[model samples]
Structures are given as structure tokens and as C-alpha cells.
Target: MATPPITFVPSPSYEAALRRAAELWGIQLEFWDIFGHHHVASPETLSSVLRSLGVSSESAQSLNAAIESRLWSEWSSPVAQTLVVSLSAGAIPIQLKDSEAGAEIRFEWESGGHTAVSVESADSIHPDTARLRDHQLIRIQVPLPKEATLGYHRVTVSTAGGRRAEGRLILCPDQAWQPDFLRRGGRGAGVAISLYGLRSHRNWGCGDFTDLEHFTQWASETTGVAFVALNPLHAIPNRQPYNTSPYLPNCSFYRNGIYLDVERLDEFTQSEWANRLLRSAKVQNCLAELRAAPNVEYAKVWRLKLVFLKLAFREWLRRNPQGTGRREVFLRYIEGEGNLLHRFAVYQALDEAVHKRDRNLWIWPDWPTTLHDPDSPQVREFESTHATLILFFKYVQWRIDGQVSAAQDFAQGLGMPIGLYHDLALATDRCGSDLWAHPQAYVQGCRVGSPPDDFSPKGQDWAFPPPNSIWHRDSGYELFVQSIRKNS
Candidate 1:
């Protein structure tokens, strides 16, 4: 039998490096020059190659002894190599030189030292014209093993002409876990309707905090309900006509300052003009009118509340000329909470940046390339200028936290088993704090939602980004734990 011709094309240094590597490994390489083509020998030809490389028996034995004593870490660098692994299934379909004539392309996985699995390419899979033109992407569904670890996996594609292309598979860890509170049953007790449905005469158009309080008191005393779960009371970006949905709020951390009780304003009592206005029975009349109404007109309630909130904010600021100590306490609370508060504040600042049009915070694709780098001066400056805004947002969150705690305390006092079980939205808003703070953790290309089932034929896109498993692991689940603790 004639041996296949193999061509060996190597620079002098390259050949020396190959010899050194083989010598260190106690292995011999069978270099064959087949006509003009050079090919490395198969595993079976390794012994002959070793002898040709001048690796004597004694030297090989010494190399093996040295290798056995060295730890694996000494040989394998932590820096992972990128490998292009291809996977396919179903009918084996391949594209030949002619598009009309298809051939079978064998697919296989060889995770060095592990059993190989043969895969069949699907006929339905076709080359993407745009991707092919750009030579940027390959369209193929790769089947991943259930036990694959998180990191880079190697993949190789081979064709008849000995052509090969390499790509990397980023295997992310599966850190999917059921939320602690979720395991305890969700919304099983009865669903509560929005308070916006309640009618009030005092309100300019919609319900107010007073109305919320009144309803809570009523529900607690009459129905023995301990907790009254309300939608986020976060401030709205627009005040002229507030948005009807509670889900899309300007800041989840801040109390809708509009909901503050006007009657509770301390400075209002000191103002003769305010006193006269109140004495005229306007305030009393509004409350009396709301008491008589059965349903809330949000527009009317908001109109009335808007006027009151503006007056209250002004009066409160005037009364606290030295700046309220509450601000200091709020700042302290956020700092104590660490990254949770810091990230929330960053989101709030980003929101303001979006509103002011000073900087494009959301989907800023056109931003200078340098700003993406963490160590860039531009990012540092942005962080510095927006630091106060972030703190302000944190202050708002502190207020909301206090309010929630108070509500829960009130409910507990009434002997409710669950006290105040707050509802967690299915996912965080894409442009909100979570996504903004941890952009790396979110998948931007796809929205997270459930597939269509018997319940509904139309699938839903919740418009929220699900956390990336890699990001969560790298962060040590700090964000996850903090979110749970805060809500709990």
C-alpha cells in the first residue's frame, strides 16, 4: 500500500516550534509532503513522526515524566480559545455548487475526549442572502447539550474541498430560579380593582391619596381585608393629563407628589389668603361633593389635585427654608442600601436625561463610540453631572419605601396573614432602571414573554428585558437578592 503524499510548508522557526511542542508532549509528529500538499499525520502516525522529529525514547520518557508532575493549570491558560461548533438535525441537506442540486452534509460534535454525536442538517434551512452577501452571519440552529457549561465552545464546519470555517458558541449558564415569593402562590386570594374607578367630587378628575386612604379604611373595616394592594404610585412625567395606566410611570421610586394630601399642608394654615380660601367652604365643599359621588372622574380629580400639589410643594419648600432633614435621611438610606439605590438613582438620572433631551439615554445608537467604554472620560463626566439627579431619584425611592412600609404595617395591625403582598411586574421596563443600570444583563434583540397557548392564540411581548444568566452570575446575584429584599 502506498502512503498518501503530504506537503510540509513551514518557516524554519515554525518547524522548530512544532518540534519543541512535540518534544515537550513526548509525542512525535509524522509530517508528510504529498506531492506539493503538506498534511499532518493522523493520530496513528504520531509515533513515526515523533521518531522523525528526533525525540529519542529516553527523552520522550523524561518529557512524559515532567508532564505527569505538572498541574493541568500550568498547561491550560484561563484565556479560552474560540471554537466554531456547528449543529444540525433532521434530514441531512447540503448545498453543492448548484443551488438546485442539494447534497448531504455530515454534522458531528467532538468535545475532545467525549463521545461524538452525529447530527443531520435540515433541508428547510437556507442560506440568508443578505448575510451571505455581507459574510457576517450563518443561519443555523445549533442543538446544545443539556449539561454544557457556561463559556465558549468550539465548532468546526468542513466541506469536501477541505475547506473549514470556525466560529464560537457562547454558552451562558442557566441560573433560572423561581422567585421566593412566587413559590408561595401569586394573586391567589382575589384580584382587586384599580382605585381610579372610584368617583370623588373633591378630585379634579380622578382619585387622590385621600380617596385611596378612604377606600383602604373601608375595605379593612368592612370586609376584614388587611392589605389593599395598589398599582405603583410613582410620579408621572406628564401632569396636564395623567396617563391612565399605572404600569408606565416616570419613576417607580418616587411618590407621585401629586398624591400628597393638600389639607395636610402646614403652611396653608398660616396663609391668610389660604385660610380665607379654605373658610369660603371651597375645600370642604369639594370633599363634601366627592363624598356624595360613587365613581371617580380622574380628569376632574387630577385637575383639583394638580392645583393643590403645586401650592403644597411651594408652601413646603418655603416652610423648610434650610432644606428638610428628610432629604439627608433619604440620602443616608440609599447609601446604606448600596448598589440597589445607586443603580436606581442612575436610572432616574437617565430618565431625566431622556426627558430634557440633554442626552439620549435610551437606545443611544449614535452615541460616540468612546462613550461605551467604562474607562472613557466622557462616561465619567456624564456620571459626575448626573450624580445629583441619581441621588434625587434615590430620595424619591426612599419616600416610596417608607410609604410601602407604612401600608404594610397598617395591614399587619389589622391581622392580615400576608400583610401587604406587592405585585412584581412580569418584567422591568426596557428603558427603566434595571435595564439602564445593567445593560449587559439584558437581551436587546428580543422581548421576554410567553408563547401563545390555549389561553390566547396571540402571543404577547411584555416589552421588558429578561436578565442575562451570565450577567447575573458575574454579579453574584447581588441585584436579585436586593430586589427581593426591598420588595419583601
Candidate 2:
């Protein structure tokens, strides 16, 4: 066998340096493209990748700086942004930068507690040098108690002269959650179906939480289905249509309001105004049109639903202007969701405001630059002016969340083991709330896709930009972490 010639630009040594740079910066150098060809990124490819990662690799000097920075950056600091240790893993490892004569670390548990034993210096803690690298570091091993709960904790390292550093301590289970259904029991069968495709006469044009509840009830009682897996219920913008594909959404953290059955809404059921609105000839006619359509007209469906939805919101607000039971609960949800919910609501309102002003405009970037930032003064002003509108979106979110929770509860009540399983889309669209809300974290220039493959030689280009893996990790997966919690 003969060795195939590998392409290395400039020279092999520069290529080696590029490889080292990629390794330091956490860029993936070797990958199997979709075409099944084993590809090692060339020097030029590495340079381009570095650019995408916001590192200057333009010339030799800059490249050397980036590589050096990448290599020694971690050792420069005694404290990292976060440290993770499995509970099953015996002692916690703490690293010190200087290995100074007098150094100590402390643990502050988020549960209103501190470490049982505190050592005055690293020498007393576990006095051992774990490794000798560019910088001298002492790995003080601290044994954890069996009762240590799983959560985010705080770890601080201090040296002589009051020089101190702090980092997050995340304690997790060594193993993933294994439900009883998957463990030793005899195997059972269940079904996975697209939420929209589940048919029932009660649903308004598309399947909904109500329909899902009914299906789960039937499947559990008669069919003996163990669990039900659903497609992504993430929100899609109305510019879209019903966005036929649940797999692609504008935002992933929030559930799509279109999935909420309007007729089942408390306001719709209770308010005379909402009832009258629903009874109007135009509303009836629009419903008929949507119900009869062979293929869904998503935007039309969403628009029609929004009209009734707004009416429901207005009626509910009219009923509860002050801090009432419902209002407080909704506000608490907004608060619990905190800035994430508020930002998404702002984006929604801003997006709709832009669309109303000019239907031709595409996304947040296409709008006035001032409105581009979720935290901008202009956006705050927009939120203040559109307070009711933002709250209305929040109400929609609450309803969707409640309905999903109810559906899951209903499944459990019916004795289903695993209950409802929700989906998370691969990535949010570049123009959507996720990207617009956190512009700094996402990679801008390139979209996500697989390279050329035998199945489709040209390959599949999913136009949405995925979170930059390097940036996401560097930031401790800031934006990506919440989506996991929300989706799961």
C-alpha cells in the first residue's frame, strides 16, 4: 500500500503549527465529511476556521500570538469559569496557578451552606502536585461528603496578599437518568408521530394539546402504548405560515402558541367578547377556509388564531387589570423564565411591529439598527410602549406551557410510563430570536450543513447558523444550556 499525498500549504511545519493552533482553540481538525471521505483540515482551512472563531490568523505573527494564547490561556488563571465533578468520582480536584507558598480554596454551596471542613492553605487540603506544566500548579484534592446534592456551587481559590479567584462547581450524577421502562422490564412498544398530523374533528385545522391528551388517553386505556413521542413544539413566526415543519422554528425555548386550542382557553370559554368575536361571520368563514384546506396555510392560520388570541388576552386583561391570581402567576412565569422569556417576547413584538410597518422587511436585522438589540434602550422603549403586547405574548406562552403540562399530566394519570416526549430542533434560524437575542455567541458567516455526500453529492444545506461549537464551549454553552433544560 502506498501513502496518499496529503495537502499541506506553505510547508509541513506551518501545517503542524496550524494543527496545534486548532487543537489549542478546540477547532476540529479531522472530520469525516458526509461524502465518507476522511478529511484532515488543510492549513488554509484551519486559518479560515480560526477567522470564524474570531481569532486573528491573518499572518505569521498573529497566528503565533493566537496559538500561544490558546496554549497558555487556561494555565494563566487558577480559577476556571466552571468545574464539573461527578458525585461518584471520589475527591474534587482544585488547581492553583502559582503554587504559591500560602494558597487555599473554599466551597460555598448554593444551598445556604459552606464546606464542612475548611483548610487554611492548599498544603493542608491535600498537598500534592498533580502535574507540572508551563505553570506550577498544585492539585488539592478535597473529598466530598455522600450527602452533597447535585447543583451549581461556588468554588473560590485565594492566595497570599488577598489575591483570590472564583468559579462554578457543578456536581452531577455519574450516570444518566434511566427510567424504569427502559431498565430490566420486558420491552414495550410505543409510537412516534408528528403532532400536527394527529387528526381529530375537535382540532382547529391542526392537532393540538387537547387532541394529544385524547390520543394518549385512548392509547393508554385500549392500545396499551407505553409512551408517546412528539415532534418539536417550538414557536415559528407567523411570517411563516404554520411553518409546516415543526423541526424548524424561530425559537426553541418557548412552545408554539398555535398548538393551544383556542376553544379550550379559559378566556375564550368565559368571556362574552371572545365568544362574540368567535361567532363573527369573518371569523367563522376563516375557520371554514382553514379547516377545508388540503394543505395548511400556516401564516393564514396563525393570523386567524392571533386575532382570537388577542381578543382572549384583552378580555382576560379587562377582567384582571391589577395583580390578580392569574396575572401574578403569569408574571411569575415571566420572572422565572426571567430575561430569556422577556427577550423572546420583545423579539416577537419587535418582529410583528416591523412586519406591520412594512411587510417587505425580513428580520430584526432588516429593521432599524436601534431595534436590533434586545437590551437596547430603543428596545426597552419599544417594550414600554408595547407593554400590553409583550404581556400578551407572555400570556400566550403561559397558556402553551400549561397545556403541554396538562397533556403530560393527563398521560401520567392514564398510567403511561414515559409520558410525553418533546423534540428539540437542530438549530434556530439565523434571522430568528435565538440569534438576534444573542448575536455575540453565534457564528455569523457560515450556515450549518454536511459536506458533499453519496446520497446527495451536493450535500444538504440547512440555512440556519448553528451556535459556534468553539464559542459555545468557551462560554460554557451559555445559550445552548437553557434550550436543553427547556426542551427536555
Candidate 3:
């Protein structure tokens, strides 16, 4: 048999504009497979990608128009949308049409102080010039001062003609935070395990922080590891097979309440109701069944733990009252967490309320359209009406944070250098609190996925919306940073 002759297809007239537009929009035009085969993006794929990014690529004129609009918007601006200044990278970039006139740069630090870019300091900074459609686009680098602290600040660029533009200026460290041992050139290893899979005779069917502390000590003693890495402790729906994966968590900023050691909490020890419930034969039977089961019973464990946590929360409220120092600590935590924790708690409260009213309502999208948005008036009313219920969820998170901290402290005290190494999941559940609370953070039309590899002949569709890079940068990447800081 003879192989068929290879057929060549003519490129579209808009192909050049499409590629240029894609490049400006940060879309990959081609890729190399693991088998050493080069794969160039087809025009259809490129158009679809451009559409997803809110750009039009239907024809040559549309492509050229989109490209021109983007370029004009960027080049005409006095400064870029965002800037990062690391310890090693000192100068900040700015753009203006008049280079001879120069521009003034001012920074408004998060600490309520202001700093102006000095003309003498940036004397050595070079200026690069380019020609736009009709005007000259000049790019200049202004030296950042050594006194700038590591945080998010606001930068304003002003021309002599009174035109100005503002952007976020993020001052970051040269590298991420590292342990002292790693900084000193020491190498170490640890046992990575799924916290939910950890079994202990004392646990209530699922692994808790108490179980973690004990396991950490044992692992360190037996394996002589510097750290014990655990799976992401992110909160999940805790339902059956569909909603239990830690990697696709209900909320990236919070931990699963099931891992909380209810018995270890002070409120649990103090609550007569909680103790009585635990002592009951009905509760004991459920605990025993869960513990003896071959797999983690996510639903049952979550239900049981939630009940105990509610009781404990009530007991805490009764014992500590509002003015006490202990109560103040929790209040401070809520305040420190700001709107992020509040929105999460509101979503949880709403989820429980809606599901209880209609047993079929599983996700936020299925809830009443009015309640879909966290900022909607109906949702705000629900939050106001169910303030105490929302506080219960917050209290659960507060207790979880304390217990997890204690476990980490125990591990560190046991001579482990890195102590607890918590993992952060890249994907957030589409139907989870994060989506319900902050839908703007993600793009709606596309799901994040990976190309085919040796592991699987078919490509993988992760089934979660890709983050909106535009939104993240506009918000100064607060949500992204919080995902890390809260998990850490």
C-alpha cells in the first residue's frame, strides 16, 4: 500500500493578525509534544482562544482592530497596570508620549506614608523611545528607593501636562520564605501522607489534628525526617465520592472542619451537652462504625463533627461572652481575615440554609438566583438575618486554625526543622464557596486543563474555571496571596 500524499492548506488572510493578536494576548501559538512533534495552533483554535480572552478575531479587520485597540490602550497609558519591585530589581518602568518633559512618580505605601521618586536617584535610568500611530511612546525606568517595604503599594505617574495614571506596585522579597535549615544549605526529606487517610484508635472515624500531632511525632522519631508533609487541608463539601477530593476544595482559604479535634477544643471539654452527646450510645456506635470502616466516610464524619462543633461553639459563646479576652481573640481573627472570612462564612451559612429548606439544592448555582451573588441584596439580607449561624461557621474555622497551629507547634518542638508542610491545591470547586463568593476571580467560559502526556493518551480537562489574570492584577493579587498565606 502507498501512503496518501500530504496535502498543504493555504493560510487565512487574517493569520498574521491572529498570531500577532495572540502574542499580545499571551496565547501560545504552538507547542511541542513529548514525542518531539511540533503542533501549531490552528486558526479556529486561535480565534476561540481570542474570544475567550474577550478579543475579536473573526476576520482580518477585526483582528487588526483588536490589536490596534490593545496597543493604543497600553502605549497611551502613563504607566503599566501593575509593577513588581524585588530587592534585586530596583527600577520601575513607566511610559509617556513626551520624554523630554519627563514625568514624576509617587508611591503611596500601605503604611500610610508617601515616597516620591527622586530625580537624582533615577538620573542613570535610561529612556527607550518608540513610535506609536502618531505620537512618540517613550518608556522610562525610575529607580525604586531602598526604604520601600515589602508590600503592596500604589504608584501614580504624572506628566507635566497634568495627565496621570495609577497602578499597583508590589514590592516582594528576592525569594519565598524558607526554613533556617534550607537557608543554611541543609537537605531534608519528609513522609507525605493524606491526613484523611491517617488512622488512629483514638480518632472519631476520620483523622483529626490530635491524630496529626501524634503521627508527626512518631514519623519524626521513626524516619528521622525534618518535616511531615500532609495533603491539602482545604475545606470540601465532604459528600460521597463526588465532593471529597482535597485537591478540588470547596474553599481554598479554609480547612475542612472534619480534621478539627472536637474533643481537644476547650469548648468541647467545657460543654455538658457535647460531652453527653459523645457519651451517648447512638454517637458511640456511629464513631465505632466509622473507625472500623475501610475507607473515610466523609459525609458521616462531617455530619458528626459539625454537630459537635456547633455545640462547642454555643458553649464557647456562653462561657466567654463578648467582652472577654478569649472572645476578643476570635473577634480579632475575624477582623484580621476581613471580608474574605465573612464572605466564606456567609456562603456556608447560606448553603446550609438553602439545602435544609430544599434537600435537592446541593450547590450555590442551584440556589435561588437572588442568592447566587454574595453581594446581592437578598444574600446580604440572608447574612443579616442569620448572623449567629454565620458566626458558627467562623467559630469552627477559628477552632480549626488553633488546633492546626498547636499540631505544628508540637511537631516543631519535637525537633523537626520544617515541622508541618501543608499543601495548597491549585483547583477550587466550581460549586464551592469560593465561586459563590468571588466569581469575578475566574473566567466563566473556559476550564483549565493540560495536554496529553505519557500518563494518559488523552488530554486532561481539570473542569475548573481558569483564573482571570486581569482581575487578579487589578486587585493587586490579594486573593492569590491570601490562598498561600492562609494555607501556610
Candidate 4:
């Protein structure tokens, strides 16, 4: 990628414009592609932009036009006009156009090992175009052929000038959704062990996914255990002396990538040093000895694994290029299922946050004015720079997911009724992604906890925010259902 040129700007007016736009849109807008071109717009900015576009004076019409116009203008002129072809869709309202010759749009797909393209709009989409006083908006709803592949399919928008815009349509598997095993059958007939708070010597500095997997394997083979309940594997902010508690993770959906088993990298390729290390009598004996041991020494194991995993990741990247079809699918999964992923990313970001102590959490909000709002431009820029760290978190979760699934498959191969069951934390940290992302859904002041009873005299304040019962009820427990679905 080429580095965009930076241009200096006049101070007061430029700063005023940015503030005005942000206030109007409720989002900070900074231009990266356009040098020194900062145009931030909020809902209010939409209204302002619409008025400037000569929409009807009625409030309702103005609001609607404002929204549509703003969305359209965001991609207009230099962004759109320069393109030989353009494409867009969904709630963001994708638009594709060609400046030269007006061309007929075509849709294509492979059928029975042969490629085909649509001849007419009636065969698939309703072709429609709208012309405003100064601009044109084209709307086409292209329908896929019945024989279209059940995964990802490309859609192409073409113009007469031979210019084209390409986009994708993902077709998810048409399987019937399964309810959580615990929910449907009431915990089943299985022994439940709390794996939380177990000390492990093999983890880096804290118990990790490797420990969980090892325990699951042992529980399955030695005892006929169907489920291994463990603590939340959420990403902790990368702060040194990392957060030791599992329940207070930054992101629940995203896996803490650091927990990826380093041993697996050996399967990728041949390295003299690695091969020799594995073949050495000392290393061989260590592996053989650990196989007979009941538990792992986490710190030692992690240190060994980290050394190899880095080498493997480098080799893997060298063989596979970025933005490939596989990579895109992976990215889509993250974007679609990223609420939890974002949490993990936020956690990692906090670890790298400025002032070392400021990990995007409120230690004492009043102390640092700059660190107060997470949505500020400074924070957003920080996130963009460290976006790869977030992706790393997602990749790690994917690897762990594969391992856990393999464990389940192994149990099922032996004809077990229930394969695997994972434990979910009762609540998330108040300063974490869950609370920050869904502010309206969380009650900030009161923390979730168990009331005092026979077990203990004083009530417990877990220091985590519980889902608002009222909101859950009204939302048909969608959050709960989604969480269960993800775990299952």
C-alpha cells in the first residue's frame, strides 16, 4: 500500500469543522484516503446535509432525505466518480455506477461445471434507477439461481464501458438450529466439575487453553466425563502482570489468541533446529514423561510453544497471501460474529494503551480527562493502528474452536451421548466491551452477585455487570440465545 501524503492545515476553522461534524453525527470522522479532508457527520449532520441538498422542508421528509443523502454523499464524487465501476449494498446501501457508456448489468454463476450469465432483469432482479436533481441512484435486486453454490458467490455489476464492480453474497448452511444441550435437557446426566481457579504450572503465567484442552482429554478418557466446564477464555488487556481472573475478560466471543497450542506448529513444516529439538533425547523424554503425568506445567509449556508458534505463523503467512478467498471468509466471520471478538481486541488494545496503567479501563475516571471516553478520536485511532492485534485474537479463537470440536468428535466416535459442554460466566466486567458496546442494555451502578445466605454472611458484589433482566425479557432473551448458540 502506498503511504498517503499528509498536508498541514489552518488550526481554528479546521478544528471547529471537525467538532461541529462530530457533534452532529455522534461519530468522529477523519479522512485517511483524502489528505486533510475531515468531514464528520452525525444524525444532525445528515439533516444539515439534506437541507443543503434541497430536500423538502417537512421534518420527517427532511430527516429521511438527510439520512439517504448523507449515506450517498459519503461515496460521491472523487470516491465514486473516479471509479470506472462501483458497487455497494445492504443497510449501507451499496451503489454501482459507470461514468461512460450506460451498460446492462449481468449476473453470473457456475452451473453443472459450466458458467452462465443472466440475459434479462426479469430472469433475476427488478432493475430500477432513480434520478435526483443532481445525481442518480440505481437499485437492482439480483436473485441467485437455484443451483447457486451454498457458500460464497460473487456478484458483478458492469457498465457499458466494460468497467465492473464486484461484491460477494454469503449463503449460510441451511441446517436446523439446535438448542443448547443444557437448556433442552436440563444439564443432562453428567458430572459437573468447576475447573475455574485451578492452578496450573504449565501456563505462561496463568492457566490457558492448553490446560483446558489437556484436562478435557483426561476427563474424557479416564472418567467417562462428557462435559468439561472451565472458566471464560476471554482476552485480558495485554497489561503486564496480566489480569489473573478468567471471568473479567475483555471479549467473550473472541478467543484469547495467546492460548493457541504451540505444539501444533510442528505439523506445518521442517526446520533443522525444531526437528533436532524434537528428536533430542531430552525433549523426547520430556514429552514421554508428560504424557504419563496427570497435569501440565503451564509456564514451561507456554514458553516452549510460543517459540515454535511464531515460526509457524511466519511460514504460514509466507505460503498464503492475505485477502485470499479463505482470508475473506475468515474476516466475514469475525465481522459477523465479532461482538465477542471486539471485546478481546479491546482487551489487547488496553494492554498497549498509553501510560501503561491506562488499559482502556477506568481505574479512576476523574484522574485522566483524555482517557475518559472510549469513543474519542484518540482512542479510535489507537484501535485502528492495533487492528491486527484484534484479528490475531480472532485467529486464536478459531484454532481453539477447532481443538475443542476435535475433542468432542473424539468422544462421539466412542459413542457418547453428549460430546462437550462449556461453562459460561454469569456476568462480564463493567468496564469491558460488553458494557461499553451495549451501554443501554447494562445497569452501571449495581453489580451482579449472590445474596448473603448460609454459605456466607456478607452478600457478594462480583464487580461484574449482569445483563439487565428487563431488557432480556423484552428482547426475547436474544442475547442469552445467541451466547448459548455460540458456545454450542
The order of the candidates by TM-score, greatest first, is 3, 2, 4, 1
Worst 10 residues of 2 by lDDT: 2-11
Q: Is candidate 2 or candidate 3 better by lDDT?
A: 3
Once superposed on the true structure, which residue ranges of model 2 sit more than 4 Å away at CA? 1-14, 32-36, 97-99, 116-135, 138-140, 145-147, 184-186, 241-244, 470-478
For candidate 1, write residues 411-454 as lDDT tens digits: 66765555554544445555444554566765565456654545
Better of 3 and 4 by TM-score: 3
Per-residue lDDT of candidate 4, residues 10-61 (tens digit): 2234334434333344433433222333444455544443233333323543
Model 1: per-residue Cα lDDT at residue 366? 36
Better structure of 1 and 3 per lDDT: 3
* Per-residue lDDT of 353 in model 4: 49
Candidate number achieving the greatest TM-score relative to the actual structure: 3
Model 1, runs deviating above 4 Å: 1-191, 195-209, 232-244, 247-328, 357-391
The models' CA-based lDDT, in order, is: 0.47, 0.74, 0.85, 0.49
State which candidate, 2 or 4, has the greater TM-score.
2
lDDT of 3 at 40: 90
Least accurate stretch of 10 residues (summed lDDT) in model 1?
71-80
lDDT of candidate 2 over 110-138, digit per residue (tens): 78777644343444443543332345555
Ranking by lDDT: 3, 2, 4, 1
